[model samples]
Target: MSSSNARTQERELTFEEVDAQIQNADLSEFENQDDANAQSLDLAAQLKKVCSVYKVVKPILSLVGNAPFLPSSWKSAVKTFNSVMSTICV
Candidate 1:
């Protein structure tokens, strides 16, 4: 086989190994549902700290909407920006 084909086969095996590892990963290490819920609450608090900064910056983004020469794509940009913020909150 060509060296390139051999390299491609090796890369495929590496990807399969990574996929298997990801599939086997779990939160079952946690003792119970309450333990998992507590960890999630902790994570939410951490994300809330990051989201506080967005609260300050979102008003700045709104200022962009007031620009006279805003491009047609400005709406799409605003939509995408809001989506990102919403995802972080979720």
Candidate 2:
């Protein structure tokens, strides 16, 4: 009835049309072994990078572990380091 109401109705209809198109579209093109393997390799590379960083930081973490609550100035850093270590250990 009003201009605002008409605009709202038009927007709702546009969304419904888009949703219907997406629901009816074919997705068979993405179902391939090569695609799956590529995704797996990418994930493995990312995990390797994380593991490398952890290895480099692990000794520093162990040194910190020897001093859990050294001083107030270092408490925040120590707490954060310990928290991260605990999370990694779990």
Model 1, position 77, has a per-residue lDDT of: 89
TM-score of each: 0.39, 0.32
Give, for candidate 1, the lowest lDDT window spanning 10 residues.
Answer: 9-18
TM-score of 1: 0.39
* lDDT against the true structure, each candidate: 0.55, 0.51
Encode model 2's per-residue lDDT on 12-87: one tens digit a residue.
2343544554566554433353846646667657565445455344444445544546765575676577567546
Q: List, in order, the clash count of every candidate structure.
A: 0, 0
lDDT score at residue 78, model 2, on the 0-100 scale: 63
RMSD of each: 15.6, 20.1
Q: In candidate 2, where is summed lDDT lowest over 10 consecutive residues?
A: 9-18
1-90 per-residue lDDT for model 1 (tens digits):
569645743432343544554465453433254646556677667577557555444444544544448885895687578668857754
